[model samples]
Target: MTWPKKYGGQERSFLDRYVVTEEFRVANAPVRAHFTADRQSGPVLLKYAADEIKKDVLPRITRGECCFCIGMSEPNSGSDLFAASTKATKTDEGWRVNGTKLWTSNAHHADYMIGLFRTSPSTEENHRHGLTNFLVDITLPGISISPVHNMAGLHEFNEVVFDDCLVPNNHVLGEINGAWKQATSELAYERSGPERFLETFYILTEMVRTLGTEPDNRSAEGIGRLVAQAHTLRRMSVSVNGMLQAGMEPVLEGAIVKDMGTVWEQALPRKARDLTAFTDIGNRTNFDRLLRYAIHIAPKLTIQGGTTEVLRSIIARGLGLR
Candidate 1:
């Protein structure tokens, strides 16, 4: 509730917001209803969108009445956002977008999408140039959404195709052909959130419960290590949030938190599985089921937001190694 008085928010500090996010993740709250909007899209709009657009969208977002999806990754350009082929051509009516976006989470249910489209052709000297961000209304005509089921048997992702979808000029999100500048700052918000490290946390919690107060040395050691890792990542995430609140873009720090956090989260399920292997809990079926589900969904932890390889490259560039 703490956003800002102007945007229908409570104007809470980043630290306060971090507390809410951590509580939600630890409890496995069903926040999918408004997760993306609250986490990244709302802030992006507040920072770079037109005033009218902000007045239209920010209130609804704060009310949890609107959902948003990002439209950056295409079939041809997953990590290399500069290679996006989705074209947004200038028109008297506005910008007409025509292209496909893959792995668009919640596109099937999202009320809006913050899309990155090619506004001009990339020059050899600047491959990252020529991209533009748009606030696309998913209800607009000529847009098609098809489901992409994951290994977990969930239809949480979709392939969104835009065929001459018209967006008003007022919906343009920042400077035309300069979205790359805006993108890095936005990604820092995404990469450093608690979700980066907490996706598979339920499995660890369940294992601890199954192990009970008295655990073997091996089980105790495994649980201790997992707790330590989770605590360290939480500290890193909070530190990044502090940087963001100070109006500084800690892209390198965000990338490092995401890189290390996702790696640990992806490996957490397997580690929990091993820890629970020799457990003698008589009625631990629930724990077993959750562990299985965690294992199924664990593979995507490092792939989403940004892939491990992409995050490492950003970190390297920030460190002056690239």
Candidate 2:
């Protein structure tokens, strides 16, 4: 995937595009390495990774020099992100962060972390107002990252421990305790993409292969239904991207994309399991490995970007819920 050339630095949505179909699935590569950089870190950095940070870190993201991980989840807080407990204190040299962060996917290999921290103590009226975003170096002193294996049988996720680690004031993103405002835009980038709905696309192709021009009613009907749902998700995702490019935060639409994408992603595996009924069906079809992997890993997709339950709350709020 060559970096699309920037047209006046407004390339988030460059209109017409042609990406490889499911044929690219069999060539599955370890995207976890660049997951944070491309997915989360890039958007945030375009705003905050200034000067030296941009020169030193941005270019290396493509060459695999700077790996990144999200720091929103915590030992005490997962879906309820306002419940985060990690703290960053002002120090003479910089800010010193402390506390443990849970469900920090791929932190072990991350060069930098876009972590959430408490810049100011939370108050009754300021519960979600004290959190801030920081770009912390995992290599900084007093910082440690440990792997947390996911049920998908992958070691990409990790737990990051911050024990008095130093992060210069330059690392602070947005304003102090103004993370919620930053998140409205940050999440637009996070939620407005095709990756969420298309992770299991490999197996979707595999099902097509197994059917081989002729299929049963169950398979035929299911495939058509899945295709229509996926197409709808893609259009919604593209619309959100258009909103993003227009310099507006499509919060409600973003929540919808994530919620629908995750739901459809979760369905891919159950459908695959039905199509494939063997522990080891290598000899039975060309898609056995792909199907097996999808069946095991599909469930994690919903929870990875955000859990189904958590995202639904956002959707409900979008619908005017308190």
Candidate 3:
């Protein structure tokens, strides 16, 4: 809803989009299908893509007919994006990309990927150089996606291999070998959002319902604490969104939100399990099932988007603590 009217959006405020996103999370909507496009890809294009590319892709994204995935992590790169070895050599035709991207979510169903590739060698003074962002059409030849199932046995992750994949020059986003600027700025949008913390919100709601009204002291205390933490996170996230709306990048604030939010969501299942241990909610099969699923998926929360270690480093640097 934040795009211009000519781009099929209502030209609404970022706050409007924020409310809709939170409601979708609360309702457990299956928004993953087009979430990356709406949240990150569309904005990236609006800021960096050529007018022709934006005209062609933004409308499709707005129509919910396109899916986009991020291609950043590699086989051994982990959270250090500069260590990525994905090679994208300029060719007569365009650019020939060759490398593997690991832990890419929604890759199997994505129509495009905003991929990071090495276009030159990093100099002695700047290791962040040589990396560039490219808009890749997933349907291009030599692009292969292999499923990487999580502990929950869900196929939300994949390993994408680009074997001599050809991308036109027009597909480049922003300056060549200057993606570091774009990448850092992009994190504010990527890291601070409702989805970062609401992945396991269903379990919280189910726990509350299972506890029923007039729950015991222990249950009441636990519920209150969790709700209070969630409320604080929402307030922080809202403030960050306001910054984004004002064309300001809250990189430090965004990293803090993701780090704290992911940690909380990851621990939620175990806390809920502990809270419900002595309760008679064993008869609540739905709660039992959800708790089990949440536990299975909790371990990956802090690893996605960015790892806890990486986020802490960002936070420390932002605070001049490191």
lDDT of 1 by residue, 64-165 (tens): 789999998999999888999999999999999999999999998899999999999988988999999899999999899999998899998899999989
lDDT of 2 by residue, 74-101 (tens): 9889877888889999989999899999
Worst lDDT 10-window in candidate 1: 1-10
lDDT, candidate 2, at 93: 94
Clashes of each: 3, 0, 0
- In candidate 2, clashing pairs total 0
Write candidate 3's Cα lDDT for 152-194 as tens digits. Answer: 8899989999999999999999999999988877898889998
Q: List the residue pairs that clash in candidate 3.
A: none
| Best-matching candidate per lDDT | 3
Kindly report which residue stretches of model 2 are placed more than 4 angstroms away from their true locations once superposed: 1-27, 276-286
After the best TM-score superposition of candidate 3, give how far the Cα of residue 42 lies from its true spot, in angstroms: 1.1
TM-score of each: 0.97, 0.88, 0.97
Candidate 3 ranges with C-alpha deviation above 4 Å: none
Clashing pairs in 1: 2-10, 3-10, 3-11
> Where is model 1 more than 4 Å wrong at Cα?
none
* Residue 135 in candidate 3, Cα distance off native in Å: 0.7
